[model samples]
Target: MTKFLLRWIASAASIYITAALFENVYITGFDAAMLAAVILGIANMIVKPIIVLFTLPINIVTLGLFTLVINGFVLKITAGLVSGFMINGLFTAILASVVLSIVHVVLSGILGVKKD
Candidate 1:
């Protein structure tokens, strides 16, 4: 439970940092970043798998690169659901998702938040 909270905070920080790194990805404040992180977590946990399953053929064709697009789609869904967390366009969302993944990894490692 404690680790989960720590990871959640780290994920929020990653979202904030990712937003800072990209002009098109706009997070109004840390509060918005936090909300966006939770929404993103939910989207990834539920929506991503369904989308991935539906796009498996394309994913195979792209050698798994389509996963990036799916990630972006999830981010877009998050933005739609969370106010003050806005992504300007699909392309920007895709790019932001990549950066977000890198930031999340680095932040998780720095915070010693291990995946279970």
Candidate 2:
């Protein structure tokens, strides 16, 4: 429970940092970042798997590199769901996703939050 909350906060911070790094990825405020984090988490949990499954052949062909595109799509879906979180284009989303992934990993490590 405590770890979950810590991880959630870390995720929010990661979102905020990622938004700060990308011009086209806009997060209105910390509140927006928090909301986007939640939506992103849900989207990754639900939508991402379905997308990965559907794109399995291409993913295989790309040696799993296509997962980055799927991550971008998930980020776009998250932006669409959150009111104050906006990603301008698929290209920006892809770039932002890469940054977000790095930020999340670093934050998770710092928070000692083990992936489940």
lDDT tens readout by residue for model 2, 73-104: 99999999899999999989998999998999
lDDT of 1 by residue, 31-112 (tens): 9988888889999999999999999999999999999999999999999999999999999999999998999999999989
Clashes of 1: 0
| Candidate 2: clashing residue pairs, number | 0
Find the candidate with the highest lDDT and give its number: 2
RMSD of each: 0.7, 0.9
**TM-score against truth, every candidate:** 0.97, 0.96
Q: What is the Cα-based lDDT of residue 89 in candidate 2? A: 99
Residue pairs of candidate 2 with colliding backbone atoms: none
